[model samples]
Target: MLEIKELRAGYGEAEILKGISLTVKPGEIHGIMGPNGHGKSTMSKILIGHPAYTVTGGGVTFNGKNLLEMPPEKRALEGMFLAYQYPVEIPGVNNAEFLRMAYNEKRKHEKLEPVDPLDFDELLNAKMKFLNMDSRFKERAVNEGFSGGEKKKNEILQMALLEPKVAILDEIDSGLDIDALKVVAEGVNKLAGPGNSLLIITHYPRILQYIKPHHVHVLIRGNIVRSGGMDLAEELETTGYDSYLKGK
Candidate 1:
């Protein structure tokens, strides 16, 4: 469970999130829909503690712990995961090695023994299979020479392996085809269970078909202007944000 109260954050000289607050309860999926420049991406970045955006006001708490004070790595250690919109291609590090280090860090924090390379490989293989990733990708450099769909699937694989308590996906469907989208959605649904939650920040609605969200929030001009059930997505698809834009 995560609670954000009166959060105001933004890039240098530009305040994007204007006192926005939303709560993600356990086992629920919350969809965020908004037009460009509405601060949806900014909200995701700030939630994950990107250095570019400063939290000028308000507080973000996870399971009653203040998240605003934690660094990005600490945030990950606290069971917060973000599927970035544009995952970069890292050429030097093998995918398996990269994930193993990350997994061990999480384990280390929990006072659990880190998995050996062989054990880590077996665990990563299961997640790779869940995402239908090719065996060759395990040896390949992280995101290097991967197609858009492959990169997205790899991100999902990380999610499955990490099993964050609260996952934030920013523009996950971007550049994904129909088949890839379904795969990603299914991975999310499979990982999301009792005591786990997902926050999907996207401009499109098609991904909702695979992972039906319990609630949807409309963000505009750094504020959540409308909060409703899934039907709110349909209204936005048909009517556009002209009325909502004007009302604001």
Candidate 2:
């Protein structure tokens, strides 16, 4: 439910995303595979309205609305979620408190009443159990003392709670072990339904092995050079991005 066309964006004067275009239909899981130094993460940030990058050209539409015109908070409220590559820690805020605030904010945008703390606890606990996360984590500071896996799991928990229409996960698999990776992937797989979509931006195909994206794209030097099915990921696993970059 998101369409991007020839989006050129960058920090300051140096352009990173040059003519990037992709469309994610409802309920489709699209994987973006690329090497470092490219504009993979930059594109994700731009989509979510991160102020660090400026959109110099082109456009993005989410669910038929002009995404480029919305602010960052408006983007999230409009059903766009970005799971960061490096989840930051907020020491003073309890994980549950932070989540509840975010969850209620989205609900408010939907013209719904705020969820009571008691009801929110029950809802949060259910998601925690489903994600196989310990309930004790709810009482801790947000990502303050969590392990790398725990931090990623927390991100998924946020996704499950928010239930955005289009979720863009940038390197969610980084720093995760095999078991942690499976748990995170499984949580993501469970979140996929008829009403939402996922854009998984990752370099390695290992996470794709579990998530099994419906489409895979190879991005090199700020441009999507090739697009294919899961086989493209497997091929990249064997051939690397070098072959794809040769003629680009």
Candidate 3:
């Protein structure tokens, strides 16, 4: 569902992603594990057109559409979902209203009518319950006072609602407890099926144990250096990332 070739992206005058080439097939969950500053997060940001990073070379095509050329909002409308490590908070807007507007906005782009409050509540509530989240969170302000774990759950809630073809999760396990992680991971697992792909950018192997990726790639110095199975993650946990550097 997503194909990236020789992608070079970075901040002004300083490249982070020297060149990244990866592909995510539909219904496959791919894991990207790397040491800090290896450009894993940079690749994720560039995929969605973050203004902070500029794509200097190569191409990104999602579901046969040009990604680098499209605007960020257009990327969202095109079924690319990103779950941020730190979700932003907008105090004035209530959570339900935020989700309502988002669901409708995407539909509007697809030439569909927005659902009414009663229908929105029914549809969104089912997903919230599926995630085992409290119903009261809908009435709260958007991340205004939510805890770190709650923000992550809210992100999963959005993912469940939006149903993107390619979902890129950046450091999703950060600050989450075992229970919260299970809930979040379970929600992702449920959402993983035909016509959907996940590219998870994470550090620890704990989340990988839950998600069970089909392919795992290790990134070193802004490049994908090693590709392996789930066993590679276990190996990394026991041996660390240094031995794999250079010719060992």
Candidate 4:
């Protein structure tokens, strides 16, 4: 449901993503594995309209809408979610309150009435149970005092609640232990279904073992040099990105 063509973007005076192109069809999970400093994360930020990067060329369309023209908040309300590699902390903001506001905002976009707090608590509780998170998390401030693994789990919880049509998870496996990684991967797998798509970017392919991708892409120097099925990830796991850099 997301189409990106010749997408070029970067900070002023320096371009990181040069002629990057990829497509994620509804219900399909796509994996992007690349070395550090490649345009994988840059392309993700640009897709969500992060102001630091300017779109110098190319275009992105989501579900037939011109995604580039929409602001970040609007893009999110339109069912685009990005789970950051480093989730930020929001002190003094109740986690449940933050999520309720975000969920209500999306509800407004869908022309539905806001959910009452009691109902919201119930819904949040259900999602928390699915992620194997304790209800105490809903009482604490967002990401504040959470361990590295906890922060990553919180990001996945947000993804579960938002239920974005096209979810871009940037390095969700980073800093996670094997147990935490499996839990996070299970959450993602549970969310995959019709009318939803996922773009999972990572440096390692271990996460793919839990959540199998329909397609795998190798991005090097801002271009997607190789595209194949899950076997590509297994190959990269054994061979690394060295061979992919040749002739690029």
lDDT of all predictions, in order shown? 0.90, 0.93, 0.90, 0.92
Q: How close is candidate 4 to the true structure, as a TM-score?
A: 0.98
| Predicted structure with the largest lDDT when compared to the true one | 2
Candidate 3 deviant stretches above 4 angstroms: 245-248
Model 4, span 97-156: residue lDDT tens: 999999999999999999999999999999999999989899999999999899988888
> What lDDT tens digits, residue by residue, belong to model 3 across residues 1-248?
79999988788999888788998899999999987788888888998889988888889898898888899999998999999988999998999989999999988988999999899999988999999999988999998899999999999999998889899989999999999999999999999997899988988888999999999999887788889889988898888788756543
Candidate number that wins on TM-score, 1 or 2: 2
Compared to the true structure, candidate 1 yields what TM-score?
A: 0.97
Q: How close is candidate 2 to the true structure, as a TM-score?
A: 0.98
Listed in order, each prediction's TM-score against the native is 0.97, 0.98, 0.97, 0.98
| Candidate 4 structure lDDT | 0.92
In model 1, residue pairs whose N, Cα or C atoms come closer than 3 Å (at least 3 residues apart or on different chains), thus clashing, are none
Candidate 2 total steric clashes:
0
Give the Å shift of residue 38 in candidate 4: 0.5
Candidate 1 local lDDT, 73-180, one digit each (tens): 999989999998888899999999999999999999999999999999888888888887789988899999998888888888888888899998888999999988
RMSD of each: 1.0, 0.9, 1.3, 0.9
Query: Candidate 1, 183: how far from true, in Å?
Result: 1.0
lDDT accuracy of residue 41 in candidate 2: 93
